[model samples]
Target: MECWDAAVSSLSLALMVLAVAYLLRQTRTPTRYGRYVPADIRCCSARLGWLVQEVPSFLLPLMLLLLTEPDTEQPGRTRRGTGRKLLVWTFMLHYFHRGRPVPLIIVLSAAIFCSINGFLQGHHLLHCAQFKDTWLTDARLAAGFLVFVLGLTINIHSDHILRSLRKPGETVYRIPHGGMFEFVSGANFFGEIIEWCGYAVAVWSLPAFAFFFFTVCSIGPRAYQHHRDYQQRFEDYPRSRKALIPFIL
Candidate 1:
């Protein structure tokens, strides 16, 4: 493993710890609403060990990336910290505001994955001068930056819309009417998928691709599940919208 990859692997451990801590804090809080997750959406605990196995998902890739050959370098290497910082802020705000455990853990997992992988990808530009002359690297980096920004923007905006839709005593769920919700039932999922996909392409590495594959496998079904649930729950739900994709399923 290169020094950079090794450092990221070590950082991954810290991230896993943070995820556990977030879950602990969320589980302890009683005032936090557990209403966001629908009963139907949750998998049975016996079948849902994957939720807690996110650490291994990340670690396994980190291990492989450590063992694999580095990707070829790209031109005009510039580290984009702006998107990363925005993600950090959004992640902190999500947990700080909601005592809920699930979203908190998801956010932590995403934060750690994006942040650590991003740092390593960006750091490569500083250390690998030969990679600075390739357009592929530049395009990948740009895509990754866009993914991070767009993903967080969609996530925060969608959550805000949903929260506003919540009435004090309401039990049943209502349709989220604004923003990307109009285009797809799972714009948040779409944003997240795009974010990781971009990251995978940017790094062009197995670890990044592993993360992307896991995300798509996990969240893609979720979007479909949410889409079906919304249609069943609301008669007036948008009929034109797909699950995760915009025009196509």
Candidate 2:
């Protein structure tokens, strides 16, 4: 099959998934106060209220960075359908729950950027549909999948450990252990960075590079904040663990 034909096929699948998600949201029932918010969202919002409060603190800086970015040059290097699948799964598992403003903003921003870039790259792939898929492309895709899976594991495992830690404790600020917690204060952020960096390698395009750049720009400071908090909150905090990396900061 032609490259254009395959790209179109993949993009069609992505659009279908989006349609399903929209329909699901539309079909959800309203609550007693006439709010359409789901229980999971409410729970998440309550749990992460402090994070919501912190969004405005970084808004000005983020806007400046995004506004000055350039467009992709070699868009054909990106795979449309596969990227969308990764994004859709990310939202379904991680972002679908109702959280406070920070998480909601993240989901919204991610959705917008992913949709737009995916379409642009997909269009490029369709335009170059006559090109053949080489063994090198297959290898890149496999590598991308492995990186994404590893990232997913890191994210879910760390989150589970943290959640479990909070269950039996009444303390508002408690240090967590196990999983990647022993290596980095922001293991979850590290996982997400890994995920996007892997994406950049897989797509091997300017758009993916931009996405990873944005991810790092956004999460890097948060990791630093958490690292500082850990040191201040616990006198016994390990000095060996870096902010976001294992042994290197």
Candidate 3:
């Protein structure tokens, strides 16, 4: 392997390790954001937080796309062509998960996470990935694409369901119904997990796979915690529903 390959592999492995650490930390005490916000912490407006968290991920890929040289062997394809494709599709996805005031620590940490992910993904795609001319027709790619679409749909719909639950001036948290919430307490998290898993499958790269692994480990506990919260909060909560994965987790 070249230096780039070694670096990326190290990054991928590091992400998985971080995932384990995050899972353990979150399991003992949940993240201090959203419903679990601590009594006293620095915070900022949700809009500003979203912008900060989302911009690095978006901009890094965009810059890579603009700066990377074209692949000489491919006639028209640039080194970061795949990054461009991803950026366009992902731009819309980033805007969906807005929220109330967010803790400053969470916001900054999330931004750093996104930035590192953006760098890893963009760099690998630009420098290391190789594809046959027939890659578009590869069964794995096609199947992964379908799965990614399905996951994205579920994620957006689940977010909608959650957002719709609370009306203006309503301070009480109501049980979210409909969508994947019928089957799993953390439908949104589940959808996100599916998205990254499918993304890993489609990309078929070490970085992508590591990202997927990290995503599962990190969010799986959060979903379970949400499930536990629901059960404790409402005695009438659906006992049949799982935490994240439908009928399983």
Candidate 4:
């Protein structure tokens, strides 16, 4: 079991490295989604795509939580109690509820990726990760939880801002203003990145770190592309704003 877990962790790390390489190439050439939606690709409704992609993130974790048994008696395994379970569930909830309109292919690919990630994270947290209830009171966990909550709030708010940008029957893209958009073109992506970083910090596990690494690799480049697109489309786009970072990058 330990060997299997180690293998999975190694595979996750490898995926993260590949994601970084892919991002390097993608930054030069954006994917065909969002503003760059390809004419050739057939896409379904955004809401449907979102549900298809994100539902597994929530469901798989919940299922794993219900099915798995923690290794409380193991010599090296720390007994994570309700606090750790709550943290894991919180992560799952973020994906379960959040929705965004995206291309069919994009959502399909995301669904596949996230399903695997959800299983790995859920399995690890429920059956593999060792945490004590008292760990919740630790400075690292407390700080990380606060950061996670803040990031989740920013992410949801940013999404709301984007959705509210277009009024009824409006299809044209507009400059997103207010909130973190004042500082970054991809405020939602930035918020997500922060959220996962906090998750990694709070969990302090290899799987969590791998998840965070993959999130940065995947979302960071997309944010860069969005920033470029905004700059090209809107001459009045904020010059001070960065891509994914607030005043940096």
Task: Return the top candidate by lDDT.
Answer: 4
* Preferred candidate (TM-score higher): 1 or 3: 3
- The true-versus-predicted C-alpha distance at residue 170 of model 1, in Å, is 3.6
Q: Report how far residue 19 has shifted in candidate 4, in Å.
A: 1.6
Evaluated with TM-score, which candidate comes out highest?
4
* Residue 118 of model 2, lDDT score: 45
Alpha-carbon RMSD, candidate 3 = 3.0
Least well predicted 10-residue stretch by lDDT in candidate 2 = 29-38
Tell me the spans in candidate 3 whose CA falls farther than 4 Å from its real position.
Answer: 1-3, 74-100
Clashes of each: 5, 3, 0, 0
Tens digits of per-residue lDDT for model 2 on 1-249?
123555545554554455455344433521111122344552324346433433332332233223423323344443333343343233223232222233454444444544544443434332332222352457776697678678767877876776676545354667888878899999988988887677666656444455566567556656766787689889999888889988888
lDDT string for model 3 (1-249, tens) is: 122888888999999899999988987899887888876787898789988986776777667657767665564334334543663344335444665678998898989988888778767776677666666667987777778788888888998888788887777788999989999999998988888777888888888888889889887888999899999999999899999988888
TM-score, cand. 4 vs. native:
0.91
Q: Model 3: clashing residue pairs?
A: none
- Candidate 2 residue-wise lDDT at 48: 63
lDDT of 4 by residue, 1-249 (tens): 332577667767876887788788786778777778767777767679868898888889888778665554655335557776877786786875556457777888889987988878887777667765467678998888888888898899999999999988888899998999999999999999889888888989888888889888888998988998899999888899999988897
lDDT of 1: 0.54
lDDT of 1 by residue, 122-148 (tens): 333323213333444366667765776
Higher-lDDT candidate of 3 and 4: 4
Against the unseen true structure, what C-alpha lDDT does each candidate score?
A: 0.54, 0.54, 0.78, 0.81
